[model samples]
Target: MTSTLALDGIKAKQQKTWASGDYGAVAALIHPMAELLVQSADLSYGARVLDVAAGTGNASLAAARCGCDVLATDYVPALLDRATDRAMAERLPLSIQEADAEALPFGDGEFDAVLSVVGVMFAPHQEVAAAELARVCRPGGTVALANWAPDGFIGGLFKTIGRHVPPPPGISPPPLWGSPDRLRELLGGSFELTITPRDFVFRFASAAGLADFFKEHYGPTLKAFEALGDNGKALYDDIVALADSSNVATDGTLKVPSRYVEVVGIRR
Candidate 1:
């Protein structure tokens, strides 16, 4: 297939993957990470904030709670529904919309800050997505991101999954966002960049429990298992093995630490 067709096919599959499962359940566990990202952004009260690929609105809600005027957007409508519900429940005045990160539905320089927490890194076209993130922010505005590092637990998990079912060729790995050098290359000329390493700890009853949780709530994991058919058990076993190896908990439970990079870019 042509490169363009390959990209189109991959993006379609990604969209479907994200839409397949109850991501909100998994996203809810990372609210602390969202809060940290907003803190790093140092958002001004009443600032206009845009959360791109805002699955279930964790960062959006964090920004809103900080008193910024927030718009939470994602390509998945079902995820937006969950975001809307969360915003309403929290009594935060935030807008939820459907938008693609590569082609954001907003005017240039429209927002004071743009935030993506484990979000935009998954965009099929990383360069276009990075450009759009820069384009939407006003001059001197901040674009903050939290992306999983390639050597982190989550990254290793993806690598393990890839061993079972490899990703499409010609597409960059999402973990590139976690590399300081890659982030600088992607955003440096248009924005001044800052990178900080951080870790998030995941606790589960056991390695098996962690695998089960992802299989049930994380779309990518769920879809991978579905695609594997009878081979899914083998993949799950690999996941459990990796989880056990990464687990830090002493009492037989799982507590895996995943490192991520916190990126801040100021529009030039």
Candidate 2:
């Protein structure tokens, strides 16, 4: 088992990496998945919902829009600040807090639904975070998520990044959350899981443009490049090539389709 201290160190680094670039630019393109997740959770009016690792409030705002009372939490306050701004602008019933995914501050059975969209999966301690997600939900409540499928574009993106700057050892990749079998192994005893594979199209003018945009505005991409130091240019070239290979657009513009799994579980 990984020591708690090392896990904490990884989490600290993750926080900095995610905060390094403007993730908002990348997140804005995935709004549809948020809506789909809210629907999958079947949240009703006045439902008490918790959005874990709710960066920029995509899931929280979506839930609030559907009449759920949402508490959006993350370890990074800067990201939470953006979520707060989004909630305020939309006049939604969403609250903000800085909380770790593995060590959630909410009470047991406190929420009717727990949601994460490309969120909680990134926690350094996967099992602990998964348990925390299940712990806070009321019996029969929903725990819905949208994770990047291991065979998808985003997964390939991370894999490419890993080749340049390998992830810390002793930690499971976040894409594992995208697997239904893995989700069952983690949460099956506590909840009945419903997993669906879906694709979300990411539009861009060109593969090179997309790569540049992500490296400049996406945290993980930026961090990977930073870690690569002088070899960062090769990483950028790899990303451009990856994006180009995944492009399904015929008109020159990019329309890359990334597969992700939508998981909706009912707590037992």
Candidate 3:
């Protein structure tokens, strides 16, 4: 592992970024990916599962619904609160913990499966986060992920945001988690990786609606606009234009397909 000095700063900023807005609303749209990840992991009934960086308990809820014992964690307290509410309403047994992906507070080999759906990839130190995921799972257990492909709509959205307000230097792009080559480099020594490409379509009334919804609900998007201040409108315009160009709906309603890669890694 590299020195933690540089990552310390990035980690702090990352926490604030995620905690800035009501991410639960934005996360709701991607909950389906969580079900897919749970299925890909092949979790068995009553298995002990850990959902790291578990935004709004998407994967955690899915696993719990399958009769698995699940512990969902996130650094942002608000997100965990939302997850807790969801679990209560569904009468599902889920334990919510406040934890950082790069430094999980759990015993080694403590879980039957570890999962992250578009979650852990945002950690400031990618390798450290990946190592933590592997460390927490028992030997022969599974680690499953649903990450946005760099060539996809969501990935392109981030790139557009970067043009407006560049991210800190020396941090790996979160979308790298979607790349099979990067996964091999990050996780090969500890696990055997299988990647499957998939698409998740975002339906909205229009391009403007999509952009407005994200600006109001997605933490990173909300924060990006805040940081832009006077230039926020310009950023919003770019996002809407991008969405408009990518809309595939023939009936006028927006249906934007975002490509992502589902990763299943069996511990070596």
Error of 2 at 168 (Å): 0.4
lDDT digits (tens) for residues 64-118 of candidate 2: 9999888999888998899988888888867899999999997899999999999
lDDT by residue (100-147, candidate 1, tens digit) is 898998999999999999999999889999999999999999999999
Q: Write the per-residue lDDT of candidate 3 for residues 49-160, one digit (tens) a residue.
A: 9999998999999999999999999998888999999999999999999999988999999999999999999998888899999999999999999999898999999999
TM-score of 1: 0.98
Clashing pairs in 3: none
Off by over 4 Å in 2: none
Clashing pairs in 1: none
Residue 99 lDDT, candidate 1, scale 0-100: 91
Q: TM-scores across all candidates? A: 0.98, 0.98, 0.97
Best by TM-score: 2
Question: What is the TM-score ranking, best to worst?
Answer: 2, 1, 3
What clash count does candidate 1 reach?
Answer: 0
The runs of at least 3 residues in candidate 3 whose Cα sits more than 4 Å from the true structure, single-residue gaps closed, are 1-3
